[model samples]
Target chain A: MTKFTTRLPLIGIGVFAVLLLVVAPAVLSEHWISNLGKYCCLAIAAVGIGLAWGRGGMLVMGQGVFFGLGAYAMAMHLTLETAGPGALPGFMILYDPLAPLPAFWEPFRSEVFTLVAIVLLPVIVSAILGYALFKRRVKGAYFAILTQALAVALAVLISSTIRETGGDTGLSNFKYFFGYVLNDEANKLMVYLIAAALLVVCLLAVWQFNRSRFGELLVATRDAEERVRFLGYDPANIKLFAFVVAAVMASIGGAMFVPIVGIITPQEIGASASILMIAGVALGGRASLFGPALGAMAIGWGQSSLGSSWPEGWIYILGLIFIFVILFLPMGLSSLFDRAKGLIRRSSDEPGPATPELREVVK
Target chain B: MSVPDASLVVSDLHVQFGAFVAVHDVSFDAHPGEVRFLIGPNGAGKTTCIDAITGLSKGTGTARFGDKELLGSPAQKIVRLGVGRTFQTASVFAQLSVLQNLDIAAGLRRSPVSLLRARRGVDASVERALEETGLGTVRDLPAGMLSHGQKQWLEIGMLLVQDAKVLLLDEPVAGMSQDERTATGELLGRVAANRVVVVVEHDMDFMRSFATRVTVLHQGRVLSEGSVAEIQADPRVQEVYLGTAGALSGALAPGAEEVD
Candidate 1:
């Protein structure tokens, strides 16, 4: 029985992988497949939120900053790649036809540098920001507000710099991905497969982290930080580590999001975007292994389908679903699975010897 | 073998909270295998003095644990240097199991990278801690579900697993039953057999039953320090702890009555 219970996670992951990578591609239409791919990117970001906000209890309300950083890096590289060496990007021609491509754009011309930046920029930023914030013992709503402020600041900064970043209109009109023809249907499907595969990889990473001793310490720090300190573990450094991991995951999601969606914008990496990422995780069961990914996809699907049908009404519908989940299903959709497992176990087992309950009695 | 002079020595220690002074020029020496009780009225600076020594609060002067100085370091650094402490309230990781709580505590003495390693069977130290704290029976239960007495035992067990040479407990038996208090007193006696255990408590009966040495604080300074017998006989100690002679018999005894 113990062995069966321990193997449950492995079995679940196997099923998830089969359904995500094998089953979905075989059945879904090309348009829906592309949509699912976008959801997978969001799911990748949600996995990080589950680690930081759910497990570590950091309440990261500004994940958009990391997501924006990753998205812009990839978008810049794609724009430069399409512009084809020494030729200015089409948008830059409209703004200032003779202006130099800018010093920052020179580095993105190298694919190696862009790829490295996608991973490192968010890691370095989160590490420095996390170290300063956590060391000073900033947490709860104060931490949340600080992060949200950073997301807003980045969005506004990007919107005002039209000459360099394409302003409120945002970066679009990509013609190639790593020198492959972007308009090809097969290539689009390939991008979808890559996004789905990366989502699975993120899940596996989180699974390893959840079972590690650091995972236990993160939960302990969440519950009683003072006790962990007295036990000789620095809570700040532990929190910083989780925060950095979350940032990297979000950055990866954003990096993939550019090719899959075919555009990158400030609106997609704003305060609302960060909150939407969290809403999906919360709807799925932020603490569970599969909750964040499934919840994110469900929310993304809702926006695509429900939003097109009713337009502005989709936000209201999404708000209602979020509220319902928060109110009735505080543990999110995953609690239903846990409840089912518990019921099955209880029905299968025989009655055991009764033991006295240990209840506290105040004198 | 234990280090030479493994005793914890504090001299001329002063604890100030902003503009207010909580402990003034306090000094004491605690050796290994000794269980010392710190007793006094509300705001007597007993907790403050312990906090300073454990690096929870900063202090002026020296708190020497063998050759290492403890006063200026951070709380986690102080704990890593061999001083461990428990809160006034029993603060265990509520979500984790009893066994996991001890496992994480034991990680303190091990390498930081040990977190990546898989958990093996109950090692000797954790096994000993679980047995010593009498928590082996319910090691698999969630710590939050444990009774108040059990939580206190679990926190103390956490200290033991860390291989702490000096253990500071705040109000160790504040809300325990009479039977639980006696059991805890016995547990402390066994736990302090090879390490320094300093308890900040208010239960006079438990203190009388377990304390080898007593330090009495009043107005942020040590009013008296001696054996239990000397403290019981001191008129000033009685006046401070028990108030007037008329009020002595109200809730607390005034050395005249047999305790135990």
Candidate 2:
């Protein structure tokens, strides 16, 4: 069963990647290819959220804090490279005149520095926050509220730091990524492939972690924290490890989002964005292996297609989807397919050989 | 005997919730290899005493396991120091399979850094604990799907896997059927062979079977302490149990021995 579950996701991802690489260019326009890249970024964040919130039972509302950290780090480097030395970036000149670049933004001039910051900054922040929260034994709704507050605070701080953070407009209008012109069609396809490849890697990492002993301890902490404590394990430490990993994943997703989507706005790393990540995970089934990534991508696609046609009604559509998922499909879309398969197997099975005791025990 | 090298020693332990003292200046020594019963009426601070011993609640005075002080340590720290406990509510990992639950409990004693790299097989300790609790049959099933009696036994299995020198159990057989209770009593007898076992219970019949010595508490103080029969005949115990000294003396006169 474990082998089947592990292989199923790998096969699904391989087939999807092949389809995107071989057939997407013929079927989808350049704009749609760009949209697919954006969806892949959201799916990456969803996979992280699923690990922390879905399986680990942490209601992380401030995944945006890590996301923002990564986005800002990448955006800073891009803005600096585009502006050249000694000249202010376009947004900086618009927001504040005659002000030097912030000291923290100085190191991002080198691509290596920016890449390292994208991963390290989120990890450091998550480690600190997780240490404080988990060591104090916070869980359930309190954890959700704490993380949400972090998202709100980070967004507000970024918005208020007009000169450095580009205020509400954010840094955008990128011309190149790794010397490849962003406007070129081949470069766009490369971005999509990179996002798709990263998503598959993240899924595999999470899948392996879930099968490991840390995963068992995490699930145990989620279900019965007191029992875990009495067994000579600190539930806080177990939870903290999972939470930090999730935060780093979200940060990497946010970093990718900046280049693929050509924007780094506060709105993309705020309360709404965090909630959207959660909604996708819940709609897809948080605990199911591929649910969060698939669900987030689906939502991202819907927003691009449906929101464009009916901007005012897209949120309503998303809300309705959430309500439907929570009501009828408590186990999410994964269970729907599972139930279908079960029904098919039941119809074909012999009745006389089945034992009632076995059914009761299994149930 | 001269304390018999107690694994758990509580000296004048006092617990309070704001102004109300729930467990007041209670002290007892649970010797290694003895099953000690803490019996009391409802709201008589049996649970509070257990909480203080396990370091789950802050209390004044001293709780020591061997040479280490348990007063300021966290519950997890106390468990690591050779003390394990079960909740009154049967707190097993409801989402994990029975086998997974045992593995986690056993894995706790292992280094957290190496927990992920541990080989995938039931440790000998976990297997022995599961067999002792008679939960070997349904070990593959999720704990949430177990019957109420089975859940209680699974919790016992978890405690056994912890391998603590002192095991504190709060109402180990509170809601079990007759057969289940008998089985649980037998399990406790086997577990008490090498470790110090302290059980808080309201059922007098169940307490009398496993306890070598029993301590009775009333209004957060030790009302009496001795064998079950000795404490049952004490006048103060009579007043607390029968609600009147005269009624208790009358009830204990003739056929109490046959009932006991």
Candidate 3:
């Protein structure tokens, strides 16, 4: 029984992989497959949130900053690829036909640099930001506000810098991905497959983190910061590590978002975007292995369907549900699995000896 | 065995919160092979003095654990310097199992890369801590489910797994039953074999039974320091801990509070 229970996670992830990589594409239409791929991108970001906000106890409200970094990096490369050598992205040409491509945007033209930036940008930014905030023991609402402020600041900065960042509309109209036509049906499917596969990889990584010693320490830090310090761990450093990991995940999600969605805007990697990511994780179960991913997909589905029909109503409904979950189901919908398991165990063992009951009490 | 046989010495330790001096003019030295007890009234600054020594508070003092200066260092730095502490309330990782709590404490020496891997089995030190604290049976149980006394033991177990040279415990036996208190006293005796075990407790009986050396603090100042008998016989400790002529009766009698 114990072995079975322990293997549940491995089994769960296996099932999830099959559902995503094998079953979904086989059954779903092309459009739905693309939508699922987009949802997978958001789900990737949600996995990171689970680690940072849920397990590490750092409520990260500005994940959009990291997401924006990845999205912009990928978008820049794709945009430059579309424009070809010597020519500029359409927006840059529209603003000033003769103005040479900015020196900063020049490096992103390399596929290697863009790919590395998608991973490294968030690592660097989050490391600096995390070190500054955590070293000072800044946490709770202050940390949330600081992160949200950064996302808001980035959005404002992008909106104001039209010539530099294409203003608010963001860099769009991508033609190719890694030199392949992104608009081609097969290539589009490949991009969706990439997103789906990456989601699985993210899940596997987070699952490993959840069971590791570092994962244990992250949780210990979350529950008892001072105690962890007395145990010879700098709580700030632990939090910083989780924050960096989360940032990278959000970045990957953003990077994937561009090719699948075919757009990169300030609005997509801003305060609302970050909060929406959090909302999905919270709704699904921030602490559980599969909760954040499933929750994100659900939110994505809602946005594509219910949101498009009654946009204002969707906002109100999402708000109400979030408030409800925060108030009553702080662990989110995923805790229901644990609760159900507990019930089954109790009911099954009712007529047994008092030994298991005693163990249950002790547990 | 680094800096072996070193004593934890605190001299002229003064801690202030703005205008309020929490611990002023306090000095105490605890050597390995002795279980030191710091006993005082509610506001006597027993916890405060340890706070300064463990880098949790700002104070003007020289707290030397072996050759290392504890003051001015960060909390984790102080811990890394082989100083571990427990809070007044039992503060174990309630969500984790008793074994996991010890594992995390023992993780100080673990490499960053090693921390990424899950435990293959119980670590030697963690196993020893579980045996010492009598938590082996409940090793897999979440700390929250443990009895109150078990939680306190788990906290001590954490310090033990940390291999702390100086264990500064705050009210480790506040709500324990007589049996649990005895078990804890024995555990401390075993732990203090080659480490400085300093306990800040209110239980006079527990102190008299286990403390090899005693320091009595009153109003942020050291009132008395000696063997257990010497502290009990001191008129000042009696007066501060009790009151007036009742000091004489309170010191010798079992019903110290009633006499006061």
* Candidate achieving the largest DockQ: 3
- What is the Cα-based TM-score of model 2? 0.92
Of 1 and 3, the candidate ahead on TM-score is 3
Predicted candidate 3 versus true structure: per-residue lDDT over A1-363, tens digit per residue: 888977899899999999998999899998998899999999999999999999999999999999999999999999999999878999998889999998989999999999999999999999999999999999999999999999999999999989988879898999999988988988988999999999999999999998999999999999999889989999999999999999999999999999999898999888999899999999999999999999999999999999999999999999998999889888999988888878887788776644453665555
- Tens digit per residue, CA lDDT, model 2, B1-260: 32455477888999998898888899988886678998776667888888887778888899888788998888888888888888777888887788888888888668767776634778998899778888888888778878888988888888888787888888878777779888988888788877888988776667767788899988888889988789878888877886775432332221111100
Q: Clashing pairs in model 1? A: none
- Docking quality level of the chain pair in candidate 3: medium
lDDT of 3: 0.89
Query: In candidate 1, what are the lDDT values of residues A1-363, reduced to their tens digit?
Result: 778977788788889889878998899998888899999999999999999988899889889999899899999999988999878888999978999988988899899999999999999999999999998999999999999999999999999999999888888888888988888988988888888888888888888788888889989998888889989989999899899999999998998899989898899999999999999999999888899889999988888898788879999988898889989888889988988876776566435322212311210
Score each candidate by Cα lDDT.
0.87, 0.82, 0.89
lDDT per residue as tens, model 1, B37-107? 88877778888888898777889999999989998999899999999988777899999999999999998
After superposition, the stretches of candidate 3 with alpha carbons farther than 4 Å from their true spots are A352-357, A360-363, B1-4, B245-260
For model 1, fnat equals 0.69
Better of 1 and 3 by DockQ: 3
Q: Backbone clashes in each candidate structure, one number apiece?
A: 0, 0, 0
lDDT (tens digit, per residue) of candidate 3 on B1-260: 22344789899999999899899879999998999998887778888998899888898979888888899999989998899999877898989988899999999999999999988898899998888898898888788878989999999988889888899988888778899989999999999988999998778878878999999888899999999889778888777766765452332332222100
Top TM-score hit: 3
Instruction: Give me the overall lDDT of model 1.
Output: 0.87
Sort every candidate by DockQ, greatest first: 3, 1, 2
Give TM per candidate.
Answer: 0.95, 0.92, 0.96
